[model samples]
Target: MGQKIIRFSDLTGTHVENDDDLVRIVVRQHPDLEDGPVEIEALGGELTAVEELALDLVTIELHRPGADEPETVVLEAEAFDRLASATPMAEVLRGAKKVACPIPSQTAVPAGAKERVNYASLEHAGRPHKGRTTDAEKQLVRQHLDRINERLAAEGVRTIDLGNAEHVVRYGLEALARERGVTLG
Candidate 1:
């Protein structure tokens, strides 16, 4: 028995806007691979820490004909470090996690009240606010922490009490809005 030596394409400069778009682009480009295999086999994780940077690490395996072997290439979610100064909007929204706000037990939507949409399954348009992963819900938190730390570095505000999940979400959302030049509220 041998471990499957998977061949990966060189995605060195591929710029995927977000996780979902990343998946779509990779699939469309590869044509042979479906979405599930790409996430499970190639990437090695459902979600990665790169999400902290408002980015996703996508592995595209190029199976070029008559080549010695396939090569693995890395694609940043939004920006191409060599050319672009900032990340693309799609990258910022891709695989963005929704900060689950707690709903009161009494106010919780009744079971099967309505068929909810899994925005995660939806495709994003060129415009913002169209995706179900709205700025209010999905905001990159870790990246925001880094930004806040930098701005307050001299002020000695490093000691942040991430007391609760919601607080973290609140902070992350605020930071993302500021960085993207948008308002979550």
Candidate 2:
């Protein structure tokens, strides 16, 4: 399940000003976009972020890769210090994973195949405005939390901690803890 770039060409400097322009060019070059979700990208775009001169607060949005929407992890000074002094990210971050893209890519491969496109490729092309997961998706994940936590723990990654507020909100930890005779913070 991987994507192969079929074609590559460079547009003029003035062409493709933004994500909208990139989509327009993609549509213009390959008129088959209406048939499926054509993968598109615009290189050399500016990186945007906030950098305060004297910062007191820090927050990071982590797309911790399963199908769920990214979580906003607020970092305390101690937490940041621990992370900063941790081992290499590749060894520490065993939980993050790359999954199937939401966009239905216009692939030459047959239907029901995976990885024609990915979140990173389509990120600059402007993703559709979809919100968080539905209640059904949440329920399905909830049913497997025990097994999931076990596997995650074995991998040395921290399990979904009911003590963490973000995890509680994301996984409905209070009800889940009550169901399993566990306590929460």
Candidate 3:
């Protein structure tokens, strides 16, 4: 893929040569736009060559935001050469202040809050079945309590002591929810 950095007075993007003698331009939008980026490609055009140098004047198809169809735009040879040059497109765009659409104020909680709320709600709603506990299950519960106590001790926090295996496991889960800032009501 052959690429050229194009920076105009108003717009900035990259022009790339694709297979079948077609060229493509990809322009990044301002962060505030939120509409997405733009893409332009050459529909049909053979590059004219004089001696060994290729001429510009390439006819390109433009795809803008909310456009009904792709439009044709003619790029001068000099403009094409500038785009094909080694200049960085980002640097060129950064030189000018980008005009962007106004960002709407956020009213809802941050995106991840809903997921945390759901998780905490589910944790509080579900309880393990109180089936007959085997010696192995009891031992596993003791191990979990020991690990929780170790963590609490390391954090200089108060450790919990539950007489039964079920109580210990329940307390450990509640502790985990609290650690994640999830209030289990």
In order, what lDDT does every prediction score? Answer: 0.40, 0.48, 0.45
User: Model 2 over residues 1-185: C-alpha lDDT tens digits?
Assistant: 99853332243344443444342224332332323334444433321222334345457666654543565556664466467455754455565676565565643566677642331221211122234443333444455666666766666666666566666666455677676676655
Alpha-carbon lDDT of model 1:
0.40
Best by lDDT: 2
| RMSD versus native structure for model 2 | 19.3
TM-score for candidate 2, please give it: 0.29
Model 3 Cα lDDT, one tens digit per residue, 67-161:
43345667775675477455664466577576575566654567677421221121211123333333233333434545645655666655544
Q: Judged by lDDT against the true structure, how good is candidate 2?
A: 0.48
lDDT of 1 by residue, 1-185 (tens): 87944344234334333444332222333434322334322222333544665646565556676433345577874343334347655565475576576868855678879543332221211112221233212333333444444544545444222444444453344444455565433
Error at 103, model 1, angstroms? 41
- TM-score-best of 1 and 2: 2
The model with the greatest TM-score is 2
TM-score for each predicted model, relative to the true structure: 0.19, 0.29, 0.17
Query: What stretches of model 1 exceed 4 Å from their correct place?
Result: 1-138, 153-160, 171-185
- TM for candidate 1 is 0.19
Q: Model 2, poorest ten-residue lDDT window?
A: 119-128
